[model samples]
Target: MSNPLFKKINIFLKVNEQTIDSYFNANDPAPIYKRQLSQEFEEYIMNYAPSIKRYSTVTYKLNCVNESDKEYLDPLVHAIRRHFSLKKSIREAEFKKFKKRNWVLLTFSLIVVMFFQGVMPLIFNVEHRIHSAFSNALDVFSWVILWKPIEKLIFYWNPFLKEISIFDKLINAPIIIVGEKKEVAPMEQEYAA
Candidate 1:
C-alpha cells in the first residue's frame, strides 16, 4: 500500500518541561512556566486544539497522520494552523487586558496613596494621634490595593509571554510530512535496542 503525503514529523521542542507529562499536561507549566502562568492558560490553548499523539521517540503525529490520503493531511494541518493563530490572538488580547488593568490600578493607587500620605497628614496636622493612625492605615491599605497589580505585572506576565512564544513556535514549527513509516532492518533494530 502507498503511504500518505506527510509523515515523520520531528518536532524540535523548545518548551523543555521537566517531564513528558508536564509537556503534554500543560495545566500550569510551572516550575516550567512557574509563576508566569496558571492552569487556565493550558485550558485556553487546549480548548480549541486537539491533543497530539506521539508516533515515536521525539516525534509526534497530528490527527489521522497515518492515513495515506493527501486530503486528510491537509485539513488537519490547516485546522492546526488556524487553531494556533486563534489561540495566539486570544493570548494577546488577554495580555493587553491585564496590562490595561495594571495601568489603571497603578494610576488609582498612586492617587489614593498620595491622598493618604500627602493629604491625610495635613488634614490631621501631623502631630495629632489621628495623623499617626491615618498614616498607618494608609500604608497597609496601599499594599493591599496594589498587591494584585504588582503580582500581575511582575510575576504573572511571563507565562502568557511564554505561551505566546510557544504558540508562535508551533505555528512556525517545521512540519515534515513524510510519505509513510519505513520498515526497519533487523540490524538497525538490534542497534537501536
Candidate 2:
C-alpha cells in the first residue's frame, strides 16, 4: 500500500532517437533546450495539469530502452524546465498587469463617485425637493459605478495565481528515468534555466 500523504503524478515520456524529436516542434530552428514543445506533447502533459494540487507532486517519468537513450534525458528535462519557466514568467507579468489595471480602474471609479457625491451636491441647494431626489439617485449611481472594479479586485485574481503556481511546480518538478527490466535510474535534482 502506498502512503496517501505522498501522492505522485507521473507524466510518462518515451525517450529515444526517434521519439525525442516528436516531443518538440520540428519547425523551431533553435537548440533542443530552447525549442518549443510540440502541440501533441503539450496536450499529453496537460491531461494531468488539472490533477496537480497544493499537496500533490509532479514527476517526469522517462522510459529509456537503450543505454544511449539515457543521454537524451538531461536535454529533455532542460527543455521542460525552460518551457514552463517561460510560462511562469509570462503569467507573473500578466498578473502584475491585472493588478495594475484593476487598481487604476478602482481609482478612476472612486474619483467619479466622489464627484457625484461632493461636487454635484453644491450645484443644487440641499433644501430643494429636486436636490433631495437627485441626491438619492446619485448615491445609488455611485455604488453602481464602483461595483465592477471592487468585484474584480476581490475575486478575479485567484485563477491567475493558481495558474502561476501550477507553472512554478512544473518548472521545478523532479525527473525519474526508468530502464527496461523495471530498473530505476537515480533521480535528478531540479534543473534551473
Candidate 3:
C-alpha cells in the first residue's frame, strides 16, 4: 500500500512561439504574461481539476524543443500563476460575501420570527380561537422564510472553498522546464513559493 499523498500529478505544456499564441487570447494585444488564457486552454487545464487533491504533488512540466523556445518559459509560467491567483482571490471575496449575506438573512429572519411569536400574542388573547391558528401559521412561515439561508449556510459553502483551494494549489504548484537534451532548468527564484 502506498500513501496517496506521495502521488505525483503532472500537467504537461509544450512551450514554443507557435503553441504559446494558442494558449492565450489571439485578439488580445497584451504581452503573454498579461493576456487572458484562451477558452480552449482553460478548458484543457480544467479537465484535470477534479483529479487534484490536497496532498497531491501537482506540477507543470514545460517541454521545449529548442533552446531558443525556452525563453518563453518564465513568461508562460508567470501567466499561469497570475491567472489562478486572480481566480483564488475572486473566489475568496465571493465566499466572504456569501457568509455575510447569509448571516444577515438569518438575523433578519430571527428578528421577524421573534416579533411574530412575541408581539402577535399580545394582539390576540390566549383563549381566542384565532390565536392558535395565527400562531401555527407564524411558525410555518418562519420555517419557510428561514429555510433557504439555513440550507445555504450548511450545505452550499463546500463548493466555494473547494474552488478556492484548487486555485491556490494551481497558483503555487512547481513548474519545471525540460529541454531537448534532457536538461532540467533550475527553478526560477521568482516562481518559488
| C-alpha lDDT score of every prediction, in listed order | 0.57, 0.87, 0.88
lDDT of 3: 0.88
| TM-score ranking, best first | 2, 3, 1
TM-score, candidate number 1: 0.59
Q: In model 1, where do residues sit more than 4 Å from their true spots?
A: 1-68, 181-193
Question: Top TM-score: which candidate number?
Answer: 2
lDDT against true structure, model 1: 0.57
In candidate 3, how many Å is residue 162 off? 0.3
lDDT score, candidate 2, position 165: 81
lDDT by residue (tens digit), candidate 2, 1-193: 6556447788889999999999999999998877899988878887887787767798888999999998888888988888888888999999999999999999999999998899999999988999989999998999898999899999999999888888887888888888876544445333321
Q: CA RMSD for every model?
A: 13.4, 8.7, 8.6
The residue ranges of model 2 lying beyond 4 angstroms of the native Cα positions read: 1-6, 182-193
lDDT of 3 at 135: 89
lDDT of 1 by residue, 1-193 (tens): 4233222334432221222233333453433212222244346444423222222112324322234444444433454465667779999999999899898988898788877777767767767777777788889998988888787789888877866765765576555555445799999999999
Model 2 clashing-pair count: 0
* Candidate 3: residue 120 Cα off by (Å): 0.3
Put down candidate 3 lDDT per residue, 1-193, tens digits, no spaces: 6567446778899999889999999899997789988889989887878887666767899999998898889888888889889889999999999999999999999999999988998999999999999989999999998999999999999999888888987898899887666544567544654
- Please report how far candidate 3 places residue 182 from its true position, in Å: 9.2
- Model 3, stretches more than 4 Å misplaced? 1-6, 181-193
Q: In candidate 3, which residue pairs get closer than 3 Å at backbone N, Cα or C atoms, i.e. clash?
A: none
Tell me the TM-score of each prediction against the true structure: 0.59, 0.88, 0.87
